[model samples]
Target: MTAATQTPMLAARNLSCVRGTQTLFTDLSLQLDAGQWLYLQGENGAGKTSLLRILAGLALPAAGSVHWQAQPISNQRSEYHADMLYLGHHASLKEDLTLTENLRSLIAMDGLKVSDAAIQDALTRMGLAKRQHLPARVLSAGQKRRGLLVRLLLRPAKLWLLDEPFNALDANAIVDLQECLKAHLKDGGMIVLTSHQTPDLGSDTAGFVLSLSRGRA
Candidate 1:
């Protein structure tokens, strides 16, 4: 099939990861298409986070290759970085900077030009408008999480890689995040996240479940 006919926005072939003589997994393969979501389910130290880093091009897999839009990611590193967003366990925001400033820096790093008004709009959507001027270090845990989430709106990328996005979030914040994710998928963005809690999004939303134990068992 031609690249245009391939529905998957991201794909992995014979992917294997290893750390210090520990082989996390081998021959792991998956596909993520626009308007779809995938959940990485596993126990602690199951390499879920490592796999995500590899997919985001933050780290290299011990073997195999990753493809974005039918092109090998390694062949177009700069282009891949521009098209993917990866949020890990630690928020990338600067603790000393105000929420708005942190977001402004992030946008600048991505080499995108956005207006101040656009930044404010994204913060508002993530429920951080009222605290936009406050130092991110002083915000409550949930508010800090929301600050990180503002990236979703301020910058538009085709792929989202989230690791425990709901960490430190209250029930309401979790619900709000679920809504944001739903809207993202509806807009044809693909998501791959690792969460311990059951997802609030429904099963019909182009979902898949990958468990580390499946192959080991």
Candidate 2:
């Protein structure tokens, strides 16, 4: 089926979150279907990261609930997680492992098996082929970011939830990532990400920012 006719991949109903007596957001709700994109805009302490964690099934919301494909994410966590990719600001990469090893380890957790040539090709495209054998701890900040991004290329899951993905990326890398995101959307993949800096996703792209402070899109 085409993305336009498919059910929403993610849905949150009357969600609320409070951290240490501080209400980050309350009575918030949103839905994301296939082939759509969501950009989160908020300042520090506005709960952008917190909300992303909640949606990604990593944190519990203070109130309300989220569903994946009409099933509560908590109940269908395995299925939900299998079809999603959550990229945090600091991706949990093993510092001692080389970039290639890290990518293989992470992908394997999702029950995916990829060939070495394919993985090497993806690293090469990220401009990391030469450094793939080096430990992630020794890589530069931008190189580490690029290494984590390789997960996106290897596993084109249905839902992509990225937190501060543009941080530490250079101008050219940023542009390349934007094009990659556009291609994913065109393939009926959905994405929800936060970026402090504005992104130019080409003139034909369809996207809108979901400002967290007001819980408005």
Candidate 3:
């Protein structure tokens, strides 16, 4: 690809992570260009979540670096964060707040202005429109997941870092979420996610896989 087309939205170089005494992975490198999707596969304790966090700039790597759009994330933290969204195992929603309230709060916290109509549109896209007035504490696992996913539509982020996004989702919800992700990628957005189950999103995008095992004692 030409230089104009060679720039990646996100890239990692020789990233090595250490959690306590455990070495998660070493010399890890990846490049996510626009409209691409990456699937991370590993055993339960293989540090997949840690890797995602590092890419999201939530945690620093023990060694090496992460770059967002050719700029070091360490130096351009705010700019990088402005263009990315990180959704972890915890949904980061207020249990006491209604679904709409939570979404509005998140958008405000991000310093982005979103209209109420847009918020409702996002909720409807995630299949949570009818329940938008209900507190998150009363929602089912899948509904809660849907409520969290509504952010994807409400905000404009170039990259999405999701950790086990399919958790607690039923088959139908899974399909719906897959479509949501597909639409994101189709719009030149990139995604990196870890999943125990395979993603059958029906897209022809290539994915890079990484696995980690304990070193010999």
Candidate 4:
């Protein structure tokens, strides 16, 4: 294959974190190539969210570095962000804005614009078509999860860092998202996420998981 077609890779080395003098974890390292889905598993207080935050560049690792395509992400901040997407446990949507409005604003932040029809379609697929006009504050926790997931359909990225992505999704919504992830992997996207629910991807895909616990005993 040509260089243009080669998939990208994300790597992290010697990552560690601390919370109020409590050492979470250390010496963590991993690499994810395009078309791979990484699942993070751990008990509560195992620093799963903290690890995801560091990898997403939302937080600094106490003693490590992250790289994309062999280049330190810090040296290429904007370029890295342009191709990376991070979705925290919270929806990150504005309660004052309707579903479509929130999505519109998110896209605009990336210097892109989508039509109302496009926004509605994404919401419809995520089972939020009926609530597209409703303010986000009125949506239940589950609905808020689905609403935030609608962003995935609206924007495509090379790397996705999701924390507890399947937390509030229902049976059908979970299935829909699993399929969406499979397709993203098929398209050579790299996803490093934390999900308690085991995603059922087709046999044709490649993925793995890393379990996080406390520091070495």
Candidate 1 to truth, TM: 0.93
Model 3: ten consecutive residues of lowest lDDT: 208-217
Clashing residue pairs in all predictions, respectively, total: 0, 0, 0, 0
Name the better of 2 and 3 by lDDT: 2
Alpha-carbon runs more than 4 Å astray in model 4: 1-8
**Model 2: per-residue Cα lDDT over 100-168, one tens digit each:** 999998888878899989999999999999999999999999999999998899996899999988999
Write model 4 residue lDDT over 1-217, tens digit each, in one string: 1123243488887888888898898878788887887888888888989988888888898888998888988999888988898999988999999988888998999887788888888888888889989999999999999988888888868888888889888888888998898888888997888877776777787777788877631
Location of the lowest summed lDDT over 10 successive residues in candidate 1: 1-10
Candidate 3 local lDDT, 66-166, one digit each (tens): 98989999899889888999999886889999999999999999999999999988788777888999989999988888788888888899899989999
| TM-score of every model versus the real structure | 0.93, 0.93, 0.93, 0.93
On a 0 to 100 scale, what is the lDDT of residue 74 in model 4?
Answer: 90
Give candidate 3 regions above 4 Å deviation: 1-6, 215-217
Each prediction's RMSD to truth: 2.7, 2.8, 2.7, 3.4
Alpha-carbon lDDT of model 4:
0.84
Q: Residue 195 error for model 1, in Å?
A: 0.6
| Better-scoring candidate (lDDT), 1 or 4 | 1
| lDDT of each candidate versus the true structure | 0.86, 0.86, 0.84, 0.84
Screening candidate 2 with a backbone cut-off below 3 angstroms (N, C-alpha, C), the clashing residue pairs are none
True lDDT of residue 136, candidate 1: 85
10 residues in a row with least lDDT, candidate 2:
1-10
